[model samples]
Target: MARAPRIEIARGTTFDQLMLWLDDMLAAFAHLPPDKHGTP
Candidate 1:
């Protein structure tokens, strides 16, 4: 099986919700140590 590995919002999802999720993800990453950012 082949597929692009990425976060996929389902069809008909709202743009605002996606943006909010992305913002939260960024915030979570911002506090991590530099070396911990590469995987997981």
Candidate 2:
């Protein structure tokens, strides 16, 4: 069986910092090619 990855955030992280991080992550995925099987 496989375990889900754990994500940890710093104690003092601000909302703006979190948003910027999310935007970066989304932008990173924007370049990915679509799945041929139509499944995520």
Candidate 3:
């Protein structure tokens, strides 16, 4: 997957930081198989 370039910002989370946070959040369910039933 292509990722956005990191940039230093003085506001809220940066793009990289947001991506990392998202990755961490999703990591909990990474082991689960794809939803073939599509019913989450």
Highest TM-score model number = 2
TM-score of each: 0.52, 0.56, 0.42
For model 3, state the Cα shift of residue 5 in Å.
Answer: 28
Candidate 3: C-alpha lDDT: 0.69
- Best-to-worst lDDT order: 1, 2, 3
Per residue, candidate 1 scores C-alpha lDDT tens digits across 1-40 of 7988776688766999899989998999987987888654
Error of 1 at 23 (Å): 0.2
Better of 1 and 3 by lDDT: 1
Q: How much is the lDDT of residue 2 in candidate 2?
A: 92
Candidate 3, residue 30: how far the Cα is off, in Å: 1.7
* Residues 1-40, model 3: lDDT tens digits: 9987765445786789978977876785674666943445
Q: What lDDT does model 2 reach?
A: 0.73
Model 2 C-alpha lDDT per residue in residues 1-40, reported as the tens digit of each score: 8986754466778899889889988876775666743436
* Clash count, one per candidate: 0, 0, 0
Q: Which residue pairs collide in model 3, if any?
A: none
The superposed Cα distance between candidate 1 and the true structure at residue 17, in angstroms, equals 0.2
Looking at model 1, report the run of 10 residues with the lowest lDDT sum.
4-13
